[model samples]
Target: MGRVTTEPSAYHRRMAEQKRSAIIDAATGLFLDSGYDGTSLARIAEAAGVSRATLFKQFPTKAALFDAIVTEYWKVEGEGGLDLRPGDLRAGLTAVGRRYVALLTRPRMVALFRIVIAEAPRFPELGQTQFKRGKMPYFTSVRRYLEAEHEAGTVRLDDPELATTQFLGMIADYVFWPRMLLVDWSPDEASMARAVDEAVLTIEARYATSSARPA
Candidate 1:
């Protein structure tokens, strides 16, 4: 029985998570196709094949759902912590840079950003929500990672925030931000990998201490 059986609560929780994913997927598509204001929670529930009661139970307001979208878009929940441990500046940054590149280049991520930019004048809350709920937490992890490296003497920085901005800015300026302005801009995987390498090298050049330099 233990081997083949599922606890009712575990099953229920799995089912609940699935429903949430469905709701988010449905809501994202609707938000993309119809715009946030043009879409409604009830419509999202219908598109998701869940009841209005269920959708409201998970997200009471459209803003709440949109916030959820931003959170999910960044995979921000379990990703609150950095993968680095305060050594190997080039290696740590290269890993982080690659992950950042992947996130920035995701199709859904671009759409999520587009929605915020497209609707910013009308629904300023969406932009604020994305910045606070989506951007800050992710950046905080990177900042903390940089701070840890600074403390360990792996990297020397007068201002970590500035360095963090500079490092991530390099990657985004190449691989990510162009998509926002140039409608057809899409760099291939090799280009993205090159961007990551270049950012890592730039940071290593400016920030990594002599001892921290790899052999």
Candidate 2:
């Protein structure tokens, strides 16, 4: 093979990414410190050390900036795709489930959820966009994992979407609404483990074939 060379465009792309990340970091800090209504575009631009025009160019509207922040919150679990291999479907799913709970149960993400829910009535599109981009993808991935496990004779599932929903519900029942929205509770490791274990057992019980059932 001939000698490889990096393109000049790559340097510009890296600089652009760094600038965008700085803007996002500034916006997130401002949003968290001051409620959405209190934060202004000029304040964000000042915090980012960029001009208003540059900030506007990167994020045309306040809603767009908020949407980007919300998207990042949803991805706090990192990008490890769920693996449903031949061995133990329930165990594999539990590993993913624990990680998912870890994301939802984080205090920062909890605050982010509260912010989204609080502003949702004024910015309905933001809520809808987040649901489409975040929740739907997560639900679909989990459902597909269950479906594949069913096909591989590792587990059994009737209506994989419903099964996935039920599994998530088991975990979210305690963590999502009550702790994040209604109450002022902070989640700990032991509590998170208990929740994930119960969720795993519930999902496995619903999907395990007769032969695959635990004793």
Candidate 3:
């Protein structure tokens, strides 16, 4: 049998993806350990086992790499895996709340927020980019869900967008802020469950239509 030859283009593409993933993995760890300003491209290149030229070829700037990290971590499904049970508003909200909490309280996410806040003053665009790309999509998804529930008469909200923001704020207040600010703060499963339960209750009390209530 004749020897088979691999296509040069295919091999290069596969190698490129591997190198990109390695850089992202290394950068994520270093960025979390050392804040944005503290970490450098050279350090990331070393950690990723690639040369400086390779790192720059993949990500031309630090901001580009940081944005990539945010996109990777913050990209969640539009519905956030909410189960839209027709009359079970509480259950749906609880599911969404739990997922939201998981996303917000992840260690890498918390670290990224800290980095953005710390470096935003110097690079204002970073904050804007994070808000537009990382945060807005989740907000929009929640708003769309609330709007759908409102149209279905399952919830009664004058402004679905505002209600969505408030619901997210409630969850963030209980889960995200503490984790972000306190170096050693870690909530047990029971505490997290309680928080999500409380959040769901709060949202339902505020917005659920009388008809949506379980008989």
TM-score of each: 0.90, 0.80, 0.83
**Model 2 — TM-score against the truth?**
0.80
* lDDT tens readout by residue for model 1, 74-193: 763235346678777887888888878877876678888888988899999999999998877778889899999999998888998999898889999999888888888988999899
The Cα local distance difference test for each model comes to 0.87, 0.75, 0.81
Candidate 3 is scored at a TM of 0.83
* Highest-lDDT candidate: 1
Candidate 2: where are CA atoms >4 Å away?
A: 1-19, 32-38, 76-80, 181-184
Give one digit per residue, the lDDT tens place, for model 3 in 31-101: 76786778999999999999999999879898899888887777665553443544567777887787788
Better of 2 and 3 by lDDT: 3
Model 2 residue 179 CA deviation in Å: 2.7
lDDT of 2 at 11: 78
Number of colliding residue pairs in each model? 0, 0, 0
Please provide, for model 2 over 1-215, each residue's C-alpha lDDT reduced to its tens digit, 9 standing for 90 to 100. 99787775877888877777778778777776786777898899999888899889879988888777766666635455665464576677787788678667654666666666776787687678768766777777778778877887867666888888888888888767677545656667788789889888877777787666666
Candidate structures ordered by lDDT, highest first: 1, 3, 2
Better of 2 and 3 by TM-score: 3
Model 3 segments beyond 4 Å from truth? 1-18, 32-38, 77-87
